[model samples]
Target: MDVPLPLVPAKILTAPTTITQFPDYPKTLILEQCKTIKDLNQIHAHLIKTRLIHNPRVAENLLESAAILIPNLPMDYPISIFEKLEEPNSACYNLMIRAFTLKQSPNEAILLFNEMCGRSVRPDEFTFPCILKACSRLHALMEGEQIHALIMKYGLGSKGFGSNGFVLNALIGMYASCGEVEVARHLFDGMSERSVGTWNSIFSGYIRSGCWEEVVGFFREMLEMEVGFDEVTLVCVLTACGRLNEIELGEWIHEYVVAKGLKGNPTLVTSLVGMYAKCGRVDTARRLFDEMPRRDVVAWTTMISGYSQANRHREALELFHEMQKTNIVPNEVTMVSILSSCAVLGALETGKWVHSYVMKKRMKLTVTLGTSLMDLYLKCGSVGNAIEVFRKMPSKNVFSWTVLIQGLANNGQGKRAIQFFNSMVEKKITPNNVTFTGVLCACSHAGLVDEGRGFFVSMTREFGIEPEIEQYGCMVDILGRAGLIEEAYQFINNMPIQPNAVIWRTLLASCRVHKKVEIAEESLKNVVKLEPMHSGDYILLSDIYASVGRLEDALRLRNQMKERVIKETPGCSVIEMNGIIHEFFSEDNIHPDLVEVYNATENMMEKIKLAGYVPNTTGARLDAEEDDKESSMSHHSEKLAIAFGLIRTSPGTTIRITKNLRVCMDCHNATKIISNVFNREIVVRDRNRFHHFKDGSCSCNDYW
Candidate 1:
């Protein structure tokens, strides 16, 4: 039998005493009055001097206050106190463990628990909870499993050892934090009495792991069990809804929130905003945002990001400006959304302002912010600035490399883009699917067919990246752009994955370039099957028919389009002049100086014809005389936009135009002649590719 220690005398416990010539004070009163480290130290000296240091009650009180309640006291002080004790009790160990857990030094708590175990001190229910909490905090799965075995060995998991809801809840949390959600769920399912905290733990785990469907399923079960949820539970469910885009369920949850009068909760309201925004209801999200009594940085960021994702870039920028007017500061996320909007709008001036703001604020150049800057500069036609940003970035991820390469390819520097890809490889950075897409695109645009084929083979064989549909589409584009129409068709037929409409459309576009009527019809057949309502495919097929002198077939197709009410998307071109985008459609007369633009276009046509330009009337579909065809081609939207750009912009300043449709052959020929006659460089970005016309020659070399 273990020997029991003698109890301390009543005089030692209750009498007034002094240590080291200090004033006499009762030890209990001193311990109770101890609030700061100074008082604890004075009481500690008194205990040591009075020979009451071994008193269990006195030791417990000192350890509890110093380890937990006393602020600004070093943890080492309480740890030293515990270490000096001859035989510390479970309560003493529990106090220190809980202290370390709260202090975020969970490994220390584990060490203390290990020391407690080594000393053969049996842990009670409270001891297990604190140590298990430490395990959860550290995500120490193996140590937690060992502690779990100990709990079972001691019967502390059952009522025999007084293990209650707190212990079980900690157990669930520990497993969940270790990423063992299934095991946590097993424990949860076996529990006869589950607390709200238990459900929250499991739900949060599923959310953290991105098991969105399971989150919904468990939430449903939680409701069936009638477990009352708090703000945390609803927030998690709403997040899941946003991830899955379950708009209806999100609305129902909103109704529930309203029914429970929880609409006033800012956190839940933020979740609702994010959910509605992600589910394609920005108006609803904005309504909730307006209703909120207070808005924080996160709420503003959410709304801004939602608008950016919805392509409402103007609104996103407006909200960002509004956020700056308030006391709330813009974070990196806010800046990123702003830059994305600028990229989409090709707003170089606005993007430059944002970049200056970032420098003035001395914000850290993180990868995400740096990538956004690169994209903004690239889309705004400033390749030099984009390259400078890429080089200055302290870190570059795969996405950074991919963006630089794609930007180069898109700007018609395909050969330089391939060189960059080689540089990326020499740096030992692994290329992902997007990186390969950029590489293949570079090869395709530069007419490096053999090199493109080699990379496509190496992607799957060497890099172990299974070719996605995007890769297959790139290959088709490669073959099609190279005039290997038969090979492109063969590749599409042999594809393991089903070809999407984009792939068929790529083949169809190439068919039009080569005037391969049979292949164009076959590609159109597949495209129409996949996307029946797509007007572009139908228009392309009709164009192909009209090009081959089959007027009846072309007219039939056009009539069918009219009967189905499939309106062709009218061709429009946008030209940015003085930071304002000017949009023009075919035969558009909307500009204030429309008459001036038309006169300039007529004069340019005359000048180009003097340079031996002849209109390619085959590009026109009207069954009329050559004069009518030539007249129809003259008023094309891109030509009108070019004329407007030439008139508005200064002489010799490169005019840039963006078109919704591919540039027709007549427009292409006329643009080359105009570039030579006017001594100006004209850059046109069509839906297909860029056409850089200078001195009677085009960058695409008549291939496009």
Candidate 2:
């Protein structure tokens, strides 16, 4: 029966249906179901065959699918489809613009918005947030302000559409991202109402601008207003706390997080760990790290970095090795921390391993990482490798240049450091305070007093950099080392700021060197007044007394020190050989090769003595006979480390040693003789500077 009826109108039965004949299911619902571009294309063909392409609803659905549903589709597909629309509304424009913004083609979003405006489609609340976000992504303050102006022109800020939280938050974020924090703050202040997101936006902006104090203030205000805080708020505030070293406040925030059951959050925990570590609470940070249920790369890196910053290099390396055992891969940040530890420990072999790993992983030598590597090699007593790393770096910032300059100066290559500094200036790289510090140090080490003075003046007059306390210390060191004790005293007296303990200590050290008893007494007075608990100050003053044959006075001072319960920081030296680090303390005999090391030391001392080396007992604090003093100097920590290194390493291999204190005159003389006798290059990095001994001479030229 049906076939018979259809035979009367075969053409009508087979023809395409009208738009109204389609299913009642929403086009948007159908679009949502279209998971892929292929599905969307089928829908597009159906829309065309049903004569529904003219239906704005169907067209809008098709555009949304093309713009948002499929991954990595060409923008041209959406744009062409949108262009074909007869009268695309603001909603359609917003969809297209949002898609472009999401795809990181922010300029295209802006163009689409302009086209929508030209077509006379009035933008609504939804339109502005998308555009503002686009501006944020592009960091285009000018474009963001224009969109803001459009919003203002439409009176959107007063009520209904313009006062939307999303739009306002997006506007604030855009301004902040463009480094226009003040403008963002003005808007934030005028907001009649705000969500937690608004507060977070302001906090993040302050953090990005390095206005950590303002971040703390905003957090306090947020707390006072009883606004709810999330993990983002805690992370930002914790970071501010760490920067300011506000440990007490950070602890309270930590307590708050724990109370809110947010401590389990990996991000908050990592921030907490970093905060504690930066605030000088590394032990607490480690405790939190251990308690974490699971650690991400950031957490592990933060913990490792915390230890490194605290100068706990052994722990840092241990933690780094532990991190390797896990599945989490190390990023540039982790490698930097590891390199820093190796630099401090002078673990050249370990540092080489890290360098090799960096190459193996194909990690790009970013400015920070490259600079860290250079610092590591230089600090580990391999100036050649450091220079190589520096030259191969693709880019150099003020910090990178400063690290190389400082490294050269520290490694007794002062003239070369100055040359590098001048080259940096010729390249128009503006030097920072640290840069000036390094250059001044170079001038001091190289005996360039006049150049040092000129640069010191030029720092303020030419570069507008006001010298800090460290710069003044370097200048005093320069004059003091050159035997201009009176000039140093005058300079300290005329300083614009009050001299700190370090300044007095530097002067006192110079007094000891120049045998200026009167100046030594005055410097010790100021040093004790500033740093009453500093054992080195008392020790140095006692040594000066002993040097002047005032043995009774020296004895009385030692007794006073014992009564005051102040303990000296024991001198320790470390040497790395065959990928192992050997540590030696003053008078230490704990190494497994102790007998061989001492035998080598005795033999080396005999040869040095035969070569006209005389043991200078000026550094021996004990009120003992000259023979006892000579024996004490022979067994010093650095000498033991050197003897151990000589016994372990191959012939002619460079011997590198790191000491916690300055090398005494006796050890310095003996090292020069040993370098000549053994035909080896000896690099000794002490508390202040480096000494390169070779062929009966030192690189410092006896100035240090």
Cα deviation of 253 in candidate 2 (Å)? 4.6
Overall local distance difference test of candidate 1: 0.85
For residues 402-423, write the lDDT of model 2, one tens digit per residue: 9999989888888899999999
Structure candidate 2, residue pairs in collision: 156-162
| All models, RMSD in angstroms | 11.8, 9.2
How does model 1 score by TM-score? Answer: 0.75
Q: What lDDT does the true structure give each of the candidates?
A: 0.85, 0.88
| Top of the candidates by lDDT | 2
Question: What TM-score against the true fold does each predicted structure earn?
Answer: 0.75, 0.82
Question: 1-704 in candidate 1: lDDT tens per residue?
Answer: 99999987766555443344543434455456677776788788878988777888778888888888888678999989998988999999899999999998999999999998998988988988899888887789999899888877777435643246777778877887788888888888888876677788778767766779988888888789787988898999999999899988899899999999998888999999999999889999999999999998889999999899998876887788788799998889988998998777666666888898889999988899999999988776678899999988999999999999987777677888889988998999999999999988888887889999999999989889999999999999999999999999999999999999999999998888787999999998898898888888887778888888887888898888889988988888877777566778887868777898899889888888888998887767556788887887898998998888788888998887777788888899999988998888887877756678899898777866
Clashing pairs in 1: none
Measured with C-alpha atoms, the lDDT of residue 325 in candidate 2 is: 88
